[model samples]
Target: MKAEAERRGYQKKMEAEKEREKPKPLSEKILLQNDVIFACKDIARNSLNYPDSFEVENTNSGIDNQNGKQIYYFTLDYSGVNAFNVRGTHTIECYGTIGDLSHSVTHKIFN
Candidate 1:
């Protein structure tokens, strides 16, 4: 009947609305690249109680630093990203400045 079809259409619209409200998660795996001049050790040595602004948050799996190994493990925070297509991958940025030197690094996280 016409009423049944209308009800079905209403239900479908509701389902579609729900789907639109819920965005598909970006990814589960994140890789962080060390774009600084020094390794973790050097960074730690230079920084002393400094404040870093990290734009993303995630769980860290581990660190990889070898040929073509440009990634670190981390969990993803969906609330961090406000825009899309910014970074081919999602990342958290940590920025710090000291005297004439400024350091910035990004960490990618997984789902």
Candidate 2:
């Protein structure tokens, strides 16, 4: 009976030690906010290389300035976010009637 009790105790101790040695998963929730700026200009006036009309449309991701010309500003409110999903560059997309264009911006949160 004493030998069986000692074996059970030793097994419990080993299980505890194993649990302590295991690495815990790394995860964290964070709040992300920033202003996304979209600069636009008339193609005819700005050397014929810019869009005639450009603006941001509201989507599931966030909100933006609805001015739709010259400059469009956006405020992001991504709260309770996961670290892994946001660990890279963020892309802000605005539609230009002439064609579709996208700008890639770096996120400082990773740094």
Candidate 3:
């Protein structure tokens, strides 16, 4: 009975995963920090749209910047992203792939 319940849960999880959308193309944007690693297999940065100085790579795993600190990670399965640095102003767009999925991230940097 327990095994059967687990099987059902697994099936539901797989179904939900299949519903995730593919990523989009890349765009231009402003990033505030250096060595910003977007650790994701599904997501990749579009090199053609970016400059040669910007370094982008695919990691087998996710971001590992946090050291012994509690951090929250949110998995986004979509085509667009709207991120704000300070809140209440500005817009910037960046793009990458999420596996075979392509998506864009809009980040705002403020000082």
Best by lDDT: 1
- In Å, residue 61's CA in model 1 sits off its true spot by 18
Candidate 2 clash pair list:
none
TM-scores for every candidate against the unseen true structure? 0.32, 0.28, 0.20
Error of 1 at 7 (Å): 1.1
Off by over 4 Å in 2: 29-111
User: Which lDDT tens digits does candidate 1 get at residues 1-111?
Assistant: 999999999999999999999977633232122323123323332232222322333323344554554334333332222234232223332322221122344432232
Candidate 1, residue 14: the lDDT equals: 100
Q: Give the CA lDDT, 0 to 100, for residue 35 in model 2.
A: 20
Clashes of each: 6, 0, 12
Clashes of 1: 6
lDDT for each residue of candidate 3 in 1-111, tens digit (9 for 90 to 100):
999999999999998787665454443211211112343212322221222222222112232234553222223222221243222221222223332122333332221
The global Cα lDDT (0 to 1) of model 2 is: 0.33
What lDDT score goes with residue 84 in model 3? 30
Candidate number that wins on lDDT, 1 or 2: 1
Alpha carbon deviation, residue 73, candidate 3 (Å): 39
How does residue 46 of candidate 3 score in lDDT? 26
Question: Candidate 1 regions off by >4 Å?
Answer: 29-65, 72-111
